[model samples]
Target: MPAADQNATPPGFGITLDTAAAEPRVVVTGELDLLTSPQLQEALAGLIADENSRRVVADLTGVTFFDSSALNVVLHAQRQAGERDVELAVVPSPAVSRVIELTGVAEHLSVADDPRP
Candidate 1:
């Protein structure tokens, strides 16, 4: 039995930040669960904290798995964005859409079918 590599990144999981756009975009891919939700939280929080940021787009179209943890992050980010006077929109993939729809959180957050506004 060999010890697992704790420092290794999970396969197919990635988070990319694009601030060059008119609105900052956080692009997420792969599974989003308890282990990876923190990363998302951090990313969104940073974007929301920017005083000049008017909107933030979270592109989850590449996500293959969505979980409650990820949903929590999204909801929290939405609230934060609102408080900061910043809009938060989510572009969901099929996997994420199912969870968002089932949880009935879709009404609470802004959802976009297309990545662009």
Candidate 2:
């Protein structure tokens, strides 16, 4: 029997912060699962905690995979943003849209088709 390749690399994951725009944006890319969700949660928490932050845009358009753990992070962030009187908008990619639609979280979250007006 052949064994799996030990040198195989895992899917790439990244998070970037962009505050140049009027609204602070967190741009996420690559796969998002239980292992990577915490990074996302932390990023969102930081933005929501900031007193100067009035609005935040989570640009998940580059994400290739979004699992239930990722969904939970987003939902938690949304709730925190609300409590802080901050607006949270999510720009989902096609891959993410399917999960949001199937989970019916679109109504609870501020889902935007585009990042800009």
Candidate 2 global TM-score: 0.88
- lDDT of model 1 at position 32: 95
Instruction: Look at candidate 2 and give me any clashing residue pairs.
Output: none
| Superposed Cα deviation of residue 30, candidate 1 (Å) | 0.4
Per-residue CA lDDT of candidate 1, range 1-117, in tens? Answer: 998776456889999999999999999999999888899999999999999899999999999999999999999999999999999999999999999989888899999988877
Root-mean-square deviation of Cα positions for candidate 2 versus the true structure, in angstroms: 3.9
TM-score of every candidate relative to the true structure: 0.93, 0.88
Give the root-mean-square deviation of each candidate in angstroms: 1.5, 3.9
Name the weakest run of 10 consecutive residues (lDDT summed) in model 2: 4-13
Per-residue lDDT value at 90 in model 2: 96
State, as a TM-score between 0 and 1, how close model 1 is to the true structure: 0.93
Candidate 2 lDDT, tens digit per residue, 1-117? 998675443568788988778888899999888877888898999988999999999999999999999999999999999999999999999989999999998999999888864
